[model samples]
Target: MTQRHIIRRVRGVDTSDGAGVKLKRVIGQPALDTLDPFLLLDEFRSDEAGDYIEGFPEHPHRGFETVTYMLAGRMRHKDNHGNTGDLGPGSVQWMTAGRGILHSEMPRQEEGLMWGFQLWVNLPAADKMTAPRYQDIDPSAIPVVHPATGVTARVIAGELAGVEGAVRGVATAPVYLDLSLEPHAAFDVPLPEGHAGFAYVFDGASAQVAGQELARGDLGAFSRIGDTVSLRAGDAATRLLIVAARPLDEPVARYGPFVMNTPEQIHEAIADFRAGKF
Candidate 1:
């Protein structure tokens, strides 16, 4: 099997979103506009309550999917579709904004370390206007597997070995994993051919992947020439998020919080939201 290598590395930029909640924008930055099927990747981490207390007020989304994984802290979310849930440490919320939806996510704690990530996955044109849905997964529902010595993987979506993750029936079959590796530990992941893949190192000094070492906050994109991903930790422990998915390979039109195939569709979404359609 061919081994995937890093073809590009992007250092995240510090940005604020959702009423001044500080975060690091990795994929949506100018350096790397996007990876096919993956539109945005944001990491929110802070111990100061002032940084995230405002949280994400009511917002509208359409024509895409959003995945939120929490590493620490607690968040409460509610949508206009009569859905409410709480996400704690190790919890994951996968929401499909098919057609349109209005939602809000707010911090549930007064003060503490809050760390998490939110990823945006694009939907094919055919499924863009389907139906809004959600997969609110608790921490205990996720499967933890040991792929190698000193390697721990929490599978949120997709399969590791023969164990399946909690999320299924997604448009773009995706594999999302939160991995922690001890110093010098190594692991090999099998990916479907032609799928887009990337690794984001969040904790630790560095991690070796695809013949290159990625420092903290670095997002490395894998080459499409391979179907296997090789990961090795450096001298210190490392924690990272690795994800892969089938590419949509279609035209993408994006606005503030809406994604569609054409500019006209985006305008229509805005008009609908203003008319209280979402």
Candidate 2:
């Protein structure tokens, strides 16, 4: 019999990023700490314009990658590398801040709900100073798979049921999927051995691999022992995002927007940013 994964921890969303934005931080917290190559996961959702209108101002980042997936609303991104794009609903933006980069993400709409997720993935020591790059994906480019009668999965960065996702070549070997299930539907997904994985419920209710229940805005982090994940929808329709990645197993030294392997590197990054070297 195959081993079934269990939830090792659960977390609720919290306020972060800047003023006017409410986010639920799943990783990078004291309870969960760092998930190896995966550093942070934040879900930003709000109906009030004031809650997100201010937007993320020009900021600097180094030694990591940022993955932004929009569920609703639109976000316009402008970076110092002459990269510009708009992330509409269901779109994905994967940006690699290998060495360093300055960018801003602002809401394009004046009102209505603005909901999305931003995940921070750490880079290994060897690639920390590599060139910056990006993958801006349209909603249509993402492949949707119907694994079962009432199950729909939007593959973003991994293969599922013989269908490979569009966002590939990530060093972390990540699996990012947006799943929707109708009432009483069950689905089983395979995970690579030794990978760290978690699920975030954004709509309705869900029963996780270990029979643990998760409602909207809740995050279920899985144990590393299992190779398969199971999920079941509640009486109502449900939607969730599942992420998994290979562990880097390296030391983490984080300083605000920068993440490095050593304290000296963190200090160097700070000094370089102040001197406009990034």
Candidate 3:
């Protein structure tokens, strides 16, 4: 028996920075509830300096992890911890905003196109106030391997090509990957037996997942599917960002950067941040 994939193509709106930086947000603020503990996802790819130069200036975040993966150009980032670095093509930075932190991502667009995606993953209630941490992974460190079907995969948070990523993250058992399928090629991505997985297609020109159809800018959220995801590309090569999150099975109460199980917990996060606690 084949179960129908309940898929939704969410057309995200365009948002402009006060500094005139333009980008598309798949999930944020108003879309927060839809993403649960995950607060937001932003895609900033631009050839014009005006569209990205503004960058995300100094901002505060707490109770989550922000994963920034660059596909092109460069991002100069600095945080309150005095940790500063530059992110170029294929680089990944996962900053765990356990307690609180202030940081900014400034564009160092030496090339024409500055492209990247930023995703916020929530922390479990017990670890919300652990500490602000980071995993600065360079492109060379990421696994870009081809196991089968002429498909190359970038392992970030899980296993691909039997080569897992080097990021030592939380215990939720999440999986994040950047996959590229050669024309007419196909492959299967392994996931936890009962985990939740989804594919976000930035270019929907020609792509399909787990026998389910998907278009550009579409998020194909899987239901009670199998453990592996089968994918194929069209005439042109296809690129997709795949992620699987563990089911916390707990209440999710969120307010901006703070994600807790209760309103008062969120309020405490705010007060703690204002008290210079990070």
Candidate 4:
């Protein structure tokens, strides 16, 4: 018999505006300890232009990585390293805030309706100040594999169905996948051993895990998942982001966008960013 992976249903969060934009946080703002190895999660969903019109202005970050995964609409981003571009639906941008860097991202082309998830993954103390880099992944470039029974998976940062995403600069050994399961269909996803992962349903529908139901914006963490985790979609089907990260088992001392092992290092990162050293 397979042991059930009992998971706690942690609802998405809602927070105030920052970064010169109106941000409704989905995670990481209030519940810091809820998800170890992960930091922030922002859901920029808006159909009104005024809500996301301002967007995020130039800001500095250090010791962490910010991943922007777009669901709908577009985002124009630019960084101090002289790199600039935009991201449409299914596009992604991962920025490593090692040492320090300044960047900005604003909505584009939608008049509104910018839906995306910006995740913050913490780096181990030893690698916190390594260096900064960015990886822009296009939707078409990311492979989408369909298994039997209407199960679809988008390979973002790890192996899936023998296909993989081209996203480099990921140190967390994390596996990010966008999964969609048809009604009445089921999926058995295999996660690496000793890893921690969660699923955030976003299809506004219901999903069943060993008969337990979960709604949209509801996050579930498997406390004791085996190599494989089972999922079954409801009548309306299920859509969610399945994220798994390798446990770092290291010290985490974070301050704002910077994550380090010591407060002084965080202070130094800020000072360097201000002093143009990073």
Candidate 5:
């Protein structure tokens, strides 16, 4: 049982997206590109109203999944399919934009801290054009487990300690866990063989993996061959998001919100969107 170590470290970049909302782009940026099945990871945390009031206007997405996890504030979302929902604190929405979909996400509050994360996951070529779907999970629906004495884990996708997450039956089998570790606490979990894993530290002083330190806003990518990944909190408490998924290993052609297998498909997607097709 070899332990996985951080093979690379990438710091988040401060950027603006979705109607001028400021966010930290952890993936899909210059420093670090896509992570196989995972395309982008954005962390939006701001107390100012001007930063997030505009929110994300109506937009179209094709051939991927968008996961919105809220830690604070509220967000209202509606899609062209007549689906509407609210994401309060601790809520999670897993939206699969298989073929195409038009949606908008706006801040429900006028002011206060708005903290959340938006993760873009890539769909395989076979399922890229499937029908769009969503899994809106409430806070109470997510399972919280104590894997260690000073550790708490919120299982969002995949399984932990024999407990399945709220999300299931996806093209890419993914594991998404929000971990909180007290001082000196350690967490160890076994990852599937050949799966890509990443850990993003959001809170606390720092975390250590394989004797290397991952500071706040730093993302650590694990070695693919290791079967297990271990994390140890520093002097203070730490909070992080750990995600793993099987890679598609296919070619990726992306244009803004559209993602496909080739340039011709990308051109087709652009034409479809321009012609009032989702």
Candidate 6:
């Protein structure tokens, strides 16, 4: 029998990021601590242009991967590696800042709603200094599936009902799914045994998880004892992002844009970035 993972905690996302852009930070806050192999999850949703216009200026990152998924508006990104791309609605950009990278993400539109999520996944010790890479995925390339009546899923990094996601070759073996459930609908997703998992509710009211209610803009971090997660929609429809990943279980040394295994490594990353070695 599959054990239903219970929601161990529920918390709100009230934070700001990248030049004053208001965002709902579901996972990276100090209160929640850190989920191994997954460092951060920030959701930015705003209709006012002033809220996001400043955007994320050029920044340096190392020893991790950043995954950006846009649901609305447009964002253009440029990296020091001469790679440039635009992210439209439903698009995804998975960047590996393995060794190091300097990049900027700025909004393309002056007005209108700009909504999206950015997730930071930590790399293992052996792969921390590997070369950077990217997986630029268009909306059309992402596979969508109707797993059951009134339920829709967009697979981003794992297989759902045998429908594979576009992202591949990730070290963490992550499962990222964008899910929508109608009123009173129920969905159960099987996860790899022992992987850490969580869900962030973005739209609608509540989700019933193991008999507990998780409200909007709230994150539900699951207990590690279950092989499957079960959720039931409230009276209204609900939209959420669910993710699971194998834990690295390694020491974490973080400073600003760098995440390394030791304080000495973080120092090296800073030195390399300042010396223009990225």
Candidate models: Cα lDDT each: 0.94, 0.86, 0.76, 0.77, 0.93, 0.88
Report the lDDT tens digits of candidate 6 across residue range 1-278: 47655545757557777798888776778766678888888889999998899999999999999999999999999999999999999999999999999999999999999999999999999999999999999999999998878889999988898989989899999999999999999978878888888888888878886566778877777777777788789789999888988899999999989999999999999899989999
lDDT of candidate 5 at residue 31, scale 0 to 100: 78
TM-score, cand. 6: 0.97
| Residue-wise C-alpha lDDT for candidate 3, range 115-210, written one tens digit per residue | 888888877878877788889998889888887866888888877767878676565677888887777888767777656656888753668687
User: lDDT: which is higher, 1 or 3?
Assistant: 1
RMSD of 1: 0.8
**Candidate 2 lDDT score at position 141:** 98
For each of the candidates, give the backbone clash count.
0, 3, 1, 0, 0, 0
Ranking by lDDT: 1, 5, 6, 2, 4, 3
Better of 2 and 4 by lDDT: 2
Give the best candidate by lDDT: 1
Point out the worst 10-residue segment of candidate 6 by lDDT: 1-10
> Any idea what lDDT model 5 has?
0.93
lDDT of 5 by residue, 1-278 (tens): 88888888999999999999999999999878998988999999999999999999999999999999999999999999999999999999999999899999999999999999999999999999999999999999999999998999999998998899999998889999999999999978778878998999998879986568999999998888887788899789999999999999999999999999999999999898889888
The positional error of residue 79 in candidate 2, measured at the CA in angstroms, is 1.0
Write the residue-wise lDDT of candidate 4 on 157-212 in tens digits: 87777776668557888889899998887887777776777777887588876456
Model 4: pairs clashing at backbone N, Cα or C within 3 Å: none
Alpha carbon lDDT at 275, candidate 4 = 85
Error of 6 at 65 (Å): 0.4
Candidates in order, TM-scores: namely 0.99, 0.96, 0.90, 0.93, 0.99, 0.97
Which ten-residue region of model 4 has the weakest summed lDDT? 13-22
Per-residue CA lDDT of candidate 1, range 164-252, in tens? 99999998999999999999999988888888989999997799888898999999999878888999998899999889999988999
Summing lDDT over every window of 10 consecutive residues in candidate 3, give the lowest-scoring window.
1-10
User: What stretches of model 3 exceed 4 Å from their correct place?
Assistant: 1-6, 17-20, 29-32
RMSD, every candidate, angstroms: 0.8, 1.4, 2.5, 2.0, 0.8, 1.2
